[model samples]
Target: MNPPNSLNPALVALDSLPLVVSLAAPIGVAYSGGADSCALLLAAAERWPGQVRALHVHHGLQPAADDFVRVCESVCTGLTLPLQVLQVDARHGPGDSPEDAARRARYTALAAAARQLRLQAVLLGQHADDQVETLLLALSRGAGLPGLSAMAPRFERDGVTFYRPLLQTPAAALRDWLVRQQIAFVDDPSNSDERYTRNRIRARLLPALDSAFPRFRQTFARSARHAAQAQELLVEVAQEDLDRVGNPPAIQALQGLSAARQANVLRHWLLRAHQATPSTAQLAQLLGQIAACTTRGHQLHLKVGSGHITRAGAVLRYTPLGDKAG
Candidate 1:
C-alpha cells in the first residue's frame, strides 16, 4: 500500500510516525460524514486505498441521520471504497441517560460489524482537541493516573484494534483540509448542546481556557502524554504486586500497599479479571470500606451491572452476581 503523502501536512507528519507503521492490520476508517471523519476517510483512501473501507454507524438519533448516511455512502462510492452502514437501537434504559446508552449501542454495533467483516482494526477520527477535552473531563471527575492518561493511539477491545491515527492532528487543521478539498459535511447540532458535560467543556471551559492561555489544547495534550507515561510505569509496578500477592487475602492485600499503589492495583485487577472500570467515586468508597472493616467474616460487596466484588476468606474475588431466579 502506498503511504498517504497527499494528505494534509499535519496528517502526513502523523503517517510518517512509527505508531501508524506498527499498527497490527490494515485500517478501516469509521466515517460519520463529519468534517473530521470525512478528512480521515479521504486521507485513508489516498494512502491505503485497497486496505481501507468506510464503516458508518447510524444511531438514528437525529432526523437527518439517514441523510448523513447517504452522504457517507456517496463519498465512499465516489472514492470507490467499500462502505458498511449499521443501524443501532440507541434508546436509553430506565434511569440511564441517552448519551451513555447511545455510545454503548454504537460501539456494540461497530464491534459486531468489525467481527462479521473479519476486519482486524477500526480507525476513529478522534483528534488532538478531543484528547485534550477527554483529559480535562477526567481531571474534573477526580480520576487518578489512568483516567488522566486519556485515549491511546491504539487500543485492543473485543478482538479488534481501534486505531486513532489522527490523534495528533488538530480539529481546525482537518476543517481547513476539508474546505480546501471542497468536501461537504454535516455539523451535528448535538455537539453544541450545553446539557452534556463534554459539550459544556468544549463550549464553555475550553474557550475560556483558550482565551486565557492560547496554547491550552497543546498544554493539556502534553499533560495527558506525561500522565500516560506515568500510568504505564504504575501499571508495571501494580502487575508486579499482583504477581507477589496473587489475589487479595480477605481484601487485606489492598491495605498493604500505599494509597496510590492500592488504587493502581485495584484498577489493574478489576480490568484484568472482569473487564470493568469502576467510577472514581465508586472505587474510592470501595477501597475505604474494604480497608476499615474489622469483622473478618463480614462480606464486602461493590456491585457494577451484574458484576460484584465479594470478600471471601482472605481473598477479594470478582464474580458475576447471580441473576434473579425465574
Candidate 2:
C-alpha cells in the first residue's frame, strides 16, 4: 500500500462531505474493506490522526468475512488507529430481504461499537453512484418522497449520528484514487451478483443512464435534495396536523382535513410513532374507512406493516400483530 501523504487535491475531492460543519471526535469510520470505505478510512485517518477509529462488521454470510476483517486489521495497524470488529447475524427474517437484513445488522453493530468506544459520530462511505442507485431503486419500487429522497448524508439511528462523508464523491474517483495510492481493499463478490436489484441497476441501468446523461449523478442528487426538502416540509406540516388531531388521531378531527392532508398526517403518524408503513392500497383503504366513519357503529380494522390499525373508541390505534391484544 502507498504510504500516507499530504492532503492533496485527490484527497480534497473525497473530503466534500458530512453536510455538517462540525462533528464531535473521536469519530469512527464504518470500514467494510471495500474501495469506497477504504478511501474514506484513509481520508479520515489522515485528517484526524489520533481522533479516528475503524469499525468493521463481519456479517458471516460469506466465506471471505474473515478475510475482510484481516484486511481491516492490517490497515488500522498501519495507521495506528484502533479497529473494532463486530460479528453480526445478517440473516433475513421471513418477510425481509437479505440486503435489508444485512444493512440493519450493520448499522446496529456500528452504532453499538461507536457507543462502546464513546465515538461521537460514525462516517459511512456510500458515494454518489450508490445514491443514484438508491434513487433508481426507489423509483422502480414506486416509493414516495421518503424513499425518493434516497439516502440522507447525515442521519441519526439507534441514538448515534451517522454521516455519509463520501455521498457526493463518485465511485470511480474513489477506486481511481485507491489505485493511484496503491491502497489495498477487498471486493465483495455479492456486489457483482446481478440477482440483487441494486447490483442489476449498477450493472445495467447506470451505464445506460451515464450514456444518456453524462451528469446524471449531479442532477439526480439535486432531485433527491429537492425531494428531501419537500419531505421535511411535509413532516413539519404532518407534525402540526398530528398535534391538532391528537396522537391516536381522533376520527372527527381527521375528517375535518382534506384527503391529501389526512394521508400526509396519517402516514407520518404511522411511520414516526409506530415505525410502521402501510402500502398505498392499505393507506388508501384506511382513508376510505375513515371517511365512512360517520357513526359510532362504523368500525375500522386494517392490517398495516407487521401491525393492525384499529379503532380504539373515537381514535385510531396501531398495535403490532405479534401482540396478543392486537
Candidate with maximal lDDT: 2
- Each prediction's TM-score against the native? 0.84, 0.93
Best model number under TM-score = 2
Global lDDT scores for all candidate models: 0.78, 0.88
Report the Cα lDDT for candidate 1: 0.78
List candidate 2 stretches off by more than 4 Å. 1-10, 13-25, 322-326
- Tell me the alpha-carbon RMSD of every candidate: 4.4, 2.9
Residue 60: error of model 1 in Å? 1.0
The alpha-carbon deviation from the true structure for residue 317 of candidate 2, after best TM-score superposition, in angstroms, is 2.4
**Residue-wise C-alpha lDDT for candidate 1, range 1-326, written one tens digit per residue:** 22333357445734754444324445677888898888888877777657777889899888989889889888888888999898999999899989879978877887888888777678788887899889988888788787898988778767877777777777887887777767788788888989898899888887798789988777888888899999899889989988766764336656777777777787788887778787777778777877776677676778753587776677777777674311
Model 2 residue 247 lDDT score = 95
